[model samples]
Structure formats: C-alpha cells, structure tokens
Target: MFNNLGNLADMMRNAGKIRETVEKATESLGQLQVEGTAGGGVVTAKANGRLELLAVRIDPKLLADGDAELLEDLVTAAVNQALTKAREAAAQSLSSLAGGFPIPGLSTLLGPGGGGGA
Candidate 1:
C-alpha cells in the first residue's frame, strides 16, 4: 500500500512537471516565429508553435482584381502552410526538451484521430 501511494505521489509530481514544461514550451513558441508562404509567396502568414497567426501578407497584385475565390484560396494556403510550420516547430522544440520522447498525443492529437478535439 505504501509503495503504491508513493508511486501515485510520484506520478502526480511528474504531471505537474510536465504541465510546467508545457507552459514554458508554449510561451517559448510565442517568442519564436515561423513564416509560411503560398502562391509563390504571393500570400504569406506568420505563426508560432501555438498555431497563433501573428501576421498575414498579401501581394498587392493579387488584391487589385479582388477575386474572392482566388483570395480565399491564397489565404487558405497561407494559413495551412503556417499551421504546418507551427506544428513542425512545436515538434522540434518538444523533441529537444523531451529528449526525443514522444509528445504523447500531439501528432495523433491534431490529426484525423483527434476525434473532434477541444
């Protein structure tokens, strides 16, 4: 009983550590910026590992015509590219911090298996 109690306590402590690590990691992500471009750089977006879009840039040439469909596509591409960059940066950062230990559900957490994440 005592051993089990000790193990449980250890797990609780580990959980807290992991929480702290994640908090720090996410905060760091905001500090690091990753840029993603689409349509041959006609559209661009900047995001952090937290997938927070900090900025978006659109080429003036593309804006003149104002084709809603093309504009939408470019925006989508830029955001998607930014999201990919954010994920990559997050994975790299987590890997470095976790010594290559898997991030538990990050990959599966965001992919199709996410099952409607929060």
Candidate 2:
C-alpha cells in the first residue's frame, strides 16, 4: 500500500502558504478604501480595514457661519458612519481572505472579519 505521509506533508505546507496568503490579504484590505457619508452627504469620511481614517470631505454649504456646532456634529456623524462602513468592509474582506477558518487572535485584533476587541 502507498504511504500517505507525503500527502500529509504537502497538505501541511499548503496550509502554511494559505496562512501567509491570509495575512497578506488582510494587509491589502487595510490599504484599500471604504467610504461613508452623513448628514445627507454634507459630510463624508473614508477609512481602511484597519479603521484608520484616510480622509474627510465637507460640503461648502456646511461651512457657513454660526454652524460650528452643526459642523462638529456632522463631522462626528460622518466619522461614525465611516467607521461603521469600515467595520463592515474589514469584516467582508477578512472573511474573503480567510476562506472560512477563523483567524488566530482575530478577536484580539481590530482587523476585518474579526471582532472589535481591538
């Protein structure tokens, strides 16, 4: 009978490669962009899978005088919206990369598809 040890070794090596690929893909998602808007699109925000803010946009009309409070609120709302989208994007991207298996320490880190423990 043919031994299965060689096949087992190959499978293990392949699994390692898969893990490496998952890590790389996770990194790539952070480099990718996910955008969100708030206050009827008066404010916009963007973030990556790592939940790092990349940019924000405010409508010129929202820059009028005596609108400091409104502006602040809009900014906050926009950022929160962006964060929500960012979380979704991260989760989807990481899930795609993971292919099904839960990532190691994923619950501890703030990466996508992982919990928000981080």
Candidate 3:
C-alpha cells in the first residue's frame, strides 16, 4: 500500500521523461531500415522500423521472364519478410526504451504474426 503509492508517485514524476523518450524512439524508427529478399535474392523488399514499406527491387531477369504469377508470389514473399523484420526491429526499439521492464502484451502486440505489419 504505502510502497505502491510511492512507486506510483515516482512513475508520475517520470512520466514526461518517458513520453520524451518514446517520441525520440518513434522518430528514429523512420530512419531505421531493414531488408528482406526472396527467390534467391531475385526479389528484395525494404521497410523501416515504423513498418512502412520503403522500396522493392526485382531482378531484371525476373521481369524479363514474364511470369506474372511467379513475380507476384515472389513480391508477396519479399514484402511479408520485410514487414516481419520491421516488426521485430520496432519491437526491439520499444523493448529497449522500456529498459527491460516488461510491458504487458508488448511482445504479442509487436512480435512477428502478432497484429501490426505491412
């Protein structure tokens, strides 16, 4: 009871600092980039830690092949892989901001196959 109250007070006192840190982390996320490739690197997708798809590159040979279905599949695979990496990176950034203090449902919220993604 008394200890809990003291802890709450401490948290309240640090709330502004926490908010600032989160803002900085979020801003940095846009600059953090990750890449994912498929079909032996024939298709590559890039995403930022904010989980936004940045760019995609397909090999010239793949385009010249004129296999639309295969190209679509490879593109999908590449995008999914990139988004997965972005999610992991974003989660890592937030986890570090938490300083090892467990946040309820954080892993599930940001982890691979959780929810948010491209």
Candidate 4:
C-alpha cells in the first residue's frame, strides 16, 4: 500500500512534465510533412502530420487530356493517401510521447482510425 501511494505521488509529480511533452509533440505535428501519389505519380498530394492537406499536384499531361473524371479520381486517391500518411505520422509522434505508458482512451482522443484528423 505504501509503495502504491509512492507510485501515485510520483505520477502526480511527473504529470506536468508529461503534459509539456505531449504539447510539444502535438506542436511538432504541424512541421511533419508527408506525400502520397496515385496513377503512377500523375497525382501527388502533400499533408502535414496534423492531417491538413498542404498541396496537390497533377501531371500537366493529365490536365491536357481533359479527363475531368479521371483527374478527379486521381486527386481523391492521392488526397486520401496523404491523409493516411499524416495520420500514421501523428500516431508515431504521440506514441513516442507516451513513452510506453498505456494511457487509457489515448487512442480515442486521437480520433477515428487511431490518429487525429484535421
């Protein structure tokens, strides 16, 4: 019982440090960038770890083809892939913040698919 109480006390003492680390990790997410591509690189999307779409690029050839539907499909695929990568990157950041402590509801806090969405 005394050991458990000591452990609790230790946790309390470290709570502030943990919160600060988490905050820094969250902030760093914005700096993390990832890219996804589709249609053999005809379409590429970039996103940050926060899951915000940064930019999308399309091959000039695709635009010249005038296939709106195909262009739309490729854009969608690339964006989704970019977001997926962002989620993974964010998860990695938060996981490192956790430092192996199994914080209950942490995954839920990250939002659907175990990574926070924009």
- Whole-model lDDT per candidate: 0.74, 0.74, 0.81, 0.81
List the candidates ranked by TM-score, beginning with the highest: 4, 3, 2, 1
Error of 3 at 99 (Å): 1.6
TM-score for each of the candidates: 0.71, 0.74, 0.80, 0.81
Model 4: ten consecutive residues of lowest lDDT:
109-118
Segments in model 2 whose C-alpha atoms lie over 4 Å from true places: 1-15, 111-118
Clashing pairs for predicted structure model 3, backbone only: none
Global lDDT for candidate 4? 0.81
Better of 2 and 4 by TM-score: 4
Clashes (candidate 2)? 2
RMSD vs true structure, all candidates: 5.4, 5.4, 4.2, 3.8
Q: Which has the better lDDT: candidate 3, or candidate 4?
A: 4
In model 4, the runs with Cα more than 4 Å from the true position are 1-9, 102-110, 115-118
Model 3 weakest 10-residue run by lDDT = 109-118
Q: Pull out the clashing pairs in model 2.
A: 90-112, 91-113
Model 1: worst 10 consecutive residues (lDDT sum): 109-118
- Summarize candidate 4's per-residue lDDT along 46-66 as a digit string, tens digits: 999877899999999999999
